[model samples]
Target: MNQIAPIRPDAARNLPQPAALRAGIGAVLDIDLDAIAANRAKLIEVAGGLDCAAVVKADAYGLGAEAVAAALARAGCDKFFVAHIDEGIALRAAVPTASIFVLHGVVPGAEGAMCAYGLIPVLSTPAQIEIWRERAARRGKNLPAALHLDTGMARLGLSEHEFYALANDPSNLAGLDLRLVLSHLAAAEEKDNPSNARQREKFEDLRKRLPKIPASLANSSGVFLGRAYHFDLLRPGAALYGIAPRADEPNPLAQVVKLSARVLRVDDLPAKTPVGYNGRYVTPAPSRIATLSLGYADGFCRALGNSRVNAGFAGQKLPIVGNVSMDMITVDASSLPPGRLREGDFVDVIGGDADSVDRIAQAAGTIGYEILTALGARFQRRHSFSNEGRLA
Candidate 1:
């Protein structure tokens, strides 16, 4: 593995700090590192001392997985979850000492990489168990792995029949070294939903039947369900990135990702002039409309078109007008105090007081998870997670 070097002084001198960068056609995404650590602390606090495993899958939900994983590791996270063997390999290379778990489990020809990278696979089926056992036996090795029992989600994990079979036959895992027994809650975020209790009961019952193994049964939302849900460890994904685990409460997680776009052109139009495609919005009076560089292609959902969403600048609100286009959205900037707005100025799209992941999702008719994960790849990303704001 190539060793990572410290940031060069020359590079540091040339690069603008996250807050100083100007937003334009090539606006950068500012990732707050201190915010990441704070968010992790909040999650740990909410989990009531349960060890927190950071989920770095989907490129850390499209915010750059390796960078996010490294930041979280430095902040005291030891366990990490990735969706595939390749992700596990990459994360292991990035944070070599961190315990990595591949949620997709073992594939027929992929066991070699798992062993090489020191990754643990979450075994989901009897077939996977048998294959892993055979491979370990052939190699004269006892590979460590975890078992995921399907409680109710039915998406992954062992079915009820498979669970019973494993429980009835201890010899099923005779030569395999099991590390953790885990299950996912289907409706943990929904406070009134009965599925949470149902899944918990099933998971507990299954745990009782199996030989003593450290258990993990919660995701982000499950951690908020209280200490009863915290078994041996808790896996948190969205919460660690600042999205609230529960839908009904104010977010406890710090906002770690911020989106800003530059104003391309500011136009002063006459009263009642239409803006955007098909006259979706018409000014009631004379207005100054600012065209922003971001649109649906940039992950700003088109559903926000014709809504009353506004971007903030210098303590002023610029209301969005007309339909959002593929590359631009016009915002009424007339209310801005003179000299407070400009063509070169940037508008807040996600972070900041005017908009958040939850607010943007509400405007887009989607969920915060989708909004965060769907953040466009075009934006240059500036990641910072340090006490003094520079990578050590």
Candidate 2:
């Protein structure tokens, strides 16, 4: 048998690179991890000597959890929070040394895996506390866990009656090393919502009843409620990933995500021509249109295309024309000079100061977290970091 000779080095050097076959057809979510570190640093500074804990729950708000956690761990973030035990275990695999706090606490049968992975559950109910305490006893030592008390959220955590019962019987906490006592803040973003102080006061009162250990009550928004809410540790989720902590106030966090879509083609329509599904929009005059390779299925909300929200490119606003389809949407590019938009040219769908994630979400009658978490898997993701500041 004769073997083929090896290709010449010069010939191999002339080979074409593998093409990004799908990147040009959808969209790209450019994630700047450096902005995340900056956000953390800002939160730490605002925390006034308190340790900051990064919340990587919801897969780091849909920006890739493992990558986000690893980047944050490198930025001196030793604490991480996840909404589920599975997320905690996965994060444990990513940053082995960091503390992974599972917000949902130990599910009844999951205690074994929880211990095996060295995961800390934020026990919220009496039964959960009892179960964790028994597990600690069975292990013949105290196990690290956090306790969550409900102040006003009325969602998770122990009710006032259950907590008082536990407080009355200190034995309930035995065999467990209580590392943190936290509460959920329902109105941290509303500066004037009297509930912030009410919850803080309630948390303070609850603290007096429990064992003296480090405690936390701050969420991403809570961190901005000032040092009183800071306590021993600050748990910031959305803010670290660039969601504005306060809704009405200016966004203090640096923008971390840039979403861009490539124009697939341009079209011209005569006056009074119908466009898009069901003809929701009709061209009043001769018009120019550019269709982008992104749509509602890609987490670019349908409300954006239908509600007259505009996309941006080189400071020019391309007003969305009609209904957003599953994988495509058309924008009115008639206002721009001819040839301004063409096939393969990228439009800044989520860029510029005006097209910030929060702004777009507001136009869609939602919040930034929804916008961030809704980011679909169709887009190409690029994660980058910088030492001096945000990565370009």
Candidate 3:
């Protein structure tokens, strides 16, 4: 089986502020670097030893790509994927030697920067292919690139007509070294969705016409669709960050994000008193309400207002009540004993349970990916390696 060189410990990055200083912050998002590495390991193992690449696009889903990608590199990951050229440029410094593939491919006239940074581009269109080919010719070298075949997503990648157009005349690819041929699965998470099989068959049919090269058809959820979708390389993004891999099955990945918010204020309200914007929720009886410092401004969805989601405190569920505002959320703490929840105390906004992310996303009528990437800059971010001992 193909493998990376032996794992090496990554040099520690700058540490976060002291707990004393963090106490003044309104919220904190604790990231488990070890969990992320383990998730990558799990994906690799499930892939039956096929190479697994980390997708750190959108700053590793807004959890700080520099730190997350560095940690993965320490755990023996040699390839990383990002959505744009700028993202690849920023991540280049963190994983200096690791293979970084820009998923969005090269923007016109930016091929020099891509080559200068030693970043590979996933060519998704014939136009992109021609630009990369032109650059390779000018440099007098076969520049590395990946071909994306659009099976069903209709989002990016080469369409069937475009792909066959090049396939008919192989000379179109002369100046580029095709590293990998890949596609995106539209509904791998659904498992029973027939589209998965259709896309796989299409990919198989399309790839056979090209020079023998590694192909990737799986994303995070695609990994769970079983070996049929594993292909030659596995490109997983959200799964490494602990998002559930499937909609119906229990999530097998470890939780990596823990979000908590400080209680800015606590109030006691009498029966029938309206709460928050437009009085969406009214107290039925005497109620203790705690105002959390996190709100929609911090990426807590306003749709969660008066939803069934709850703020966690010492295993207690403080049901979120009233509307989620720009900078505050009100949760009913009447169930907690007096003084249990006080000003300055912290409550779990998300990531308390194994499925907290999924649960919260469901309540907000969105997906876990949105919840993660939408997190704003207000929270004090900390990355932990508590599971490092296992990897060692």
Candidate 4:
């Protein structure tokens, strides 16, 4: 058998920088790593001194988990949460010392790997509890895990009867070392919603029943529900990626991701010329149209068609016209001053001081969370960071 030779650290200096590869790409997703760290700090501040655990599930809401987790860990985020065992394993490799809690709990045969990797499972059912007990007994070792009780989410948690059984027979929790007791808030984002108080009351009741264990009852939206909602710890996901928890207030997060696409071609159209598929838009006058390299495949929704969306270029507002195609869209550049616009130049999709995730969401008839998470993976990604101080 032949063994592969290991490359020396000194040889890495000869490797080309990754950013240089994107020099010719028509589009790119610029990610701000510093914005992510600052977002974590803001979440901590909003938590009012409570320990904030970074939620890196769904690849950190599609913004790249390892990169996001590594940055957050450096910013003092010790506890992390993910939706699956694989995510836990990947995150463990990224931040070895950070405690990773698997939200989906144990799934049949995955118990051993969970223990081997030092990943804590959030047990949500009696079968999961049994599995953990049997695995711990077989290994002759106490496994760390958290118990998730269903408050009002009606998702991924033990029912009331299961909770009563666990409460009655605390020995069922034996062999398995319980670290944190948690429940999900279904409507924490809607501050005035009755479900928030109801869930909090139920969780508090459960905490009283299991007096020895520390309890967690908050998610991203729950952190804004005041100190009462902040128990032993708070897990925030979307807010860390610059998505606002509430719609009424100004977004407390900085722009962390920006999408930009280049102009593929420029065409001069006569008055009344139809553009794109279905002839959805007609030029009211002779117009100079620039075809863009972005479309629905890049996560720009088709519903955004027919809307007069603006793209910034050389301090001019270029209006989007006609239907958004699979890999292209047409923009009106007739108003662009001479020498200020040209083919191959990039247009901002999100980010910059002018265009924001909120504005994009508004134009798409959606929320900022959708706009950020829906961003596609086809574009080259660049991650950076900054410290802009806290909002007063």
Candidate 5:
């Protein structure tokens, strides 16, 4: 097996250029690291004096976790979160000095690796707590860990009853150095949801019962729920990647990614001409059709194949038509200016340069997160390293 050498932040220029690799691929995912740092700045500004933690889980929501984490770390992010221990471990290698929290906790034998890698598992259940304690005892040291209490979202974390049980017995926390207490929000984005108040109150009440350690209850949206949900730290994930933390509101974060693909072919199809596989679409008139070097296999949702969802070129909306093939998608370019589009011309498909992720998501009947993380690797990635304000 060939081993890939580690690439340092300073050596980023020497790393494989996925962005320029579009020699034949035709598609490019332009990632703006500066925009990400600016997003963190926005988060910090909103956080007041509280520390801001970045959630780089799902490979920084599929924008490449290592690069993103390194950028965040430079921008003063000291803490990070990933859902699984494996994600935590991989991230630990990238940002060695930063604290990495495993939201999913440890998995039996994986306890050794978890502790060895200096990961702080969010001990949410008694089983996880017990295994973590055992790992600490075997190592003859009280290892650091975080406690997750169930405030409202019954997803993970200790229930009210179990929380109180641990509060009553200090011995349950032995061999574990509780560094922070955290909880998740069910709908902090709703803004007016009563659950936000209920969870905030519950978290405040639970903190008094538990050991005196810092507590965090907000995710991306929770930060906007005001200082009450800010707690001692703010954990934001999607917002850092340009995902709107709240629904039906203007996204405050900078657009971090722009996906564009080349026009593979263009031709005029007369009325009644069948398009793509299964004839999902038929020409309504003599329409100029363009085939993009992109499709469902590249994480473009299949449901968006023949839907109202469209692409963009030269400040014009190019409607997608026909079934989205594994490697290509056809778009109606009849609305484009005469000869404005041709073979090899690039068109913005996902974000920034054209339709926002939110708008495109509405067309696909999905959310911005689904679109961002589902982005496949076929497209070469180009990251904006400049510290300029913003492009759009």
Candidate 6:
């Protein structure tokens, strides 16, 4: 067998920089774990010292749950909320000491796995409560869990009749340790929306009926609704990932993600030249078009190409001018002087600005959460951290 020769470090310098290769390599997703930690700390401060739990569901909003949960745990975040039992189980290894709560509770016959993994289920229905209570009784010890009350969202949690039934028949909760009672907010982002107060009042009224357990009624936007919604715990998901907490408001959280696409090729097309599929965009004048190595498949929404969005290189805003392809999109870079943007260069499809995610989401006709979670597996993900203030 022939052995390959090893290139020396000095000789390697002549070749394409792996550093450069990665910078211009397809789609790049740069995630700042430190910024996420900082965002959690900011939420904790905003909650006025209330226990703030990190929501790492949907793979930490598609940023990688293991890394995000570990970073939060190191930052002194002891409580974490995931949307599913499997998510909590997967995150168990990353934050062994943190309290992992499963927001969707457990399916029937899966109670053993929840306990085996030490995950607390958020019982949202009478059926789920009965299952947990039976499991606790079988185990001959109290199993910790959270009770979710339906405080106007009407999506999850026990209904008003069920809630009162449980309140009247406290025996239904026997053998289970109800650590927390929580509810979801529907329009916490709409500060002036009357529903917020109604939900708060409903949650308050419901909590009074149950045992005086610590309660949580605030989500990311709820944290901004002042101390009344703060309650005993705050579960913030989107805000931690740098999504704007409210519509039309400045995002105070540090930007945590920067997505860039590599320039694959550049073309010079004359006036009246049609571009992309179906000629959705036609060049009104001679144009300099740079093809990027990302599209709808890479989480760059196709609607963006139709909505007059701009990708950035240096300080120049390059308008996307064509239908988005599965693996490419063309941007008109004519505004920049010739040779400024080369085939190997990269441009910001989603930049580091706080509003970049929301802005692009609006253009794509979706919310930021969808934008983040839709990020495909094709991109190279880079997680970084910095020594900033402590999250505790």
* Cα lDDT computed for each candidate against the true fold: 0.79, 0.82, 0.86, 0.79, 0.83, 0.84
How does residue 270 of candidate 1 score in lDDT?
A: 89
Which TM-score value belongs to model 4? 0.90
Clashes of 5: 0
Worst 10 residues of 4 by lDDT: 1-10
**Number of the top TM-score candidate:** 3
Q: Which stretches of candidate 6 lie over 4 Å from their true place?
A: 1-25, 353-355, 386-392
Q: What lDDT is reached at residue 173 by model 4?
A: 82
Q: Give the TM-score of candidate 1.
A: 0.91
Two-way TM-score contest, 2 vs 3, winner:
3
Candidate with better TM-score, 4 vs 6:
6
Clashes of 6: 0
Better candidate number, 2 or 6, judged by TM-score: 6
Query: Which regions in candidate 2 have their CA more than 4 angstroms from the true location?
Result: 1-25, 352-354, 386-392
Q: Could you give candidate 2's per-residue lDDT for residues 24-115 as a string of tens digits?
A: 45787777776787788788877775799999999899888887787777667899999999998887877888899999999789999999
Clashing pairs in 6: none
For each candidate, how many residue pairs have backbone atoms clashing (under 3 Å)? Answer: 2, 0, 0, 3, 0, 0
What's the lDDT for residue 239 in model 3? 95
lDDT digits (tens) for residues 150-242 of candidate 6? 988879999888989888977878988888999999998899999999999998998998647999999999999999999899999999998
Q: Give the distance in Å from residue 378's predicted Cα in candidate 2 to where it truly belongs.
A: 1.3
How does each model score on TM-score?
A: 0.91, 0.90, 0.93, 0.90, 0.92, 0.91
Stretches > 4 Å off in candidate 3: 1-23, 353-355, 388-392
Answer with 2 or 6, whichever has the higher lDDT: 6
Model 4 misses residue 95 by how many Å? 0.6
Q: Tens digits of per-residue lDDT for model 4 on 289-346?
A: 8888888998888877664567666666677788999999888888876546577788
Q: How should the candidates be ordered by lDDT, best one leading?
A: 3, 6, 5, 2, 4, 1
**Which numbered prediction scores highest in lDDT against the true structure?**
3
Candidate 4 RMSD computed on C-alpha atoms after optimal superposition onto the true structure: 6.8
Cα displacement (angstroms), candidate 3, residue 44, comes to: 1.6
Prediction RMSDs, each to the true structure:
5.1, 8.7, 3.0, 6.8, 5.3, 8.2
lDDT (tens digit, per residue) of candidate 3 on 1-392: 33323223345443222233264899999887778888888888788877899999999998999888888887778899999999999998888898999999998878889999999999998899999999988999999999999999999999999999999897988998888999999998898899999999999999999748889999999998889999889999999998998856788887888899999899999999999999999999999999989889999899988847887888888889999999999999898899888899888889772138988888878889999999999998887766541322
